[model samples]
Target: MATQPTMSEKRWLRALGATLWPSFLVAAGASIVFFANIDPETLRLDSLPGIEISRMSGYAIGFFMFWMVGLASSLLTLLLLNPTPERGPWH
Candidate 1:
């Protein structure tokens, strides 16, 4: 038997899903499209001179970078969508 999640836990899980799932999808598509036209080695050299990065590592890094961007966008969207709680009249 499994214990049911509390309301807070449920809300946390929902927020996580909302944030991660969409970002993951966006990252996947962005990685494919971006990497298709650009060479990671060239990108790495131009962006980070003197740093040696493997193609596989570059792909991973790119994917993660895209994911982070997506996460920020999603989080901002969530924050904007949430309504501000009412405060007592103070002018």
Candidate 2:
């Protein structure tokens, strides 16, 4: 049987994940937006979903969208890799 991880260990891993996800994902998102040179005006995205979004706001939203996707991926990974109760052969 494998031993359970300490509480501090779990917390440290979580903190590391939290810090890494936003930093990398958000930077990637911003880079994509900049390199793509997407013009919201041309796409008529200013009034998207009835909300007024400026050029700067568009980049901000892009960052948040990337963060959200990263968060989902991170959560899925954690859920899949997290330990579950082990069943003994007798049980």
Candidate 3:
């Protein structure tokens, strides 16, 4: 018979898997909304009413925000649902 996974191991696996796709979805959705609402001409620093930061900074901030949110959520879920230590198959 196969041994069952320990609670810690299961928590870790779930957290890692949960972090990927949801994060991507949020990031993509935000990007779409940002582009849709903002004027294209304002995207450039050399143009009138242009943003101060370079274009690369926007991408970096988006990526960082997505990753941080995903990671934090995953960890919080694991902590909240953490399993108590097993007392054999009896208890």
Candidate 4:
């Protein structure tokens, strides 16, 4: 017979899977936006307007930021919803 996962394990697995894909999607989308907006030839420091700076950096930073946020949020949600596992030598 196949062994069933404990509830907490199942929950964490679900959360991890859910978090991973969405984070990847967000990162990919942001990278796309970054590549789309900024001209490689015109990557000068003084060329960017204030708003453009925010938008451009948002694309770059948001990619990683959102990914981390998604991962952390999912893990936190899992932790909040599931009971804590007991620590042991094997655990």
Candidate 2: C-alpha lDDT: 0.62
lDDT of 2 at 35: 39
**Model 3 pairs whose backbones collide:** none
Off by over 4 Å in 1: 86-91
- lDDT on C-alpha atoms for all candidate structures: 0.87, 0.62, 0.62, 0.62
Name the lDDT value of residue 88 in candidate 1.
18
Clash count per candidate: 0, 0, 0, 0
Q: Write the per-residue lDDT of candidate 3 for residues 12-65, one digit (tens) a residue.
A: 566667766676777677666776675444555435354476556656665577
lDDT of 2 by residue, 4-89 (tens): 88877777677567656765676686658653887654444544656666767666666676766676766665555545646311
Candidate of highest TM-score:
1
- Candidate 1 per-residue lDDT, tens place, 12-90, comes to 7887889899999999999999999999999988999788899999999999999999999988877666656462111
TM-scores, all candidates, are: 0.86, 0.55, 0.48, 0.45
On a 0 to 100 scale, what is the lDDT of residue 40 in model 1?
95
Candidate 2: which stretches are off by over 4 Å?
1-23, 26-37, 44-50, 86-91
**What's the CA RMSD for each of the models?**
4.9, 7.8, 6.9, 7.8
lDDT of 4 at 34: 62
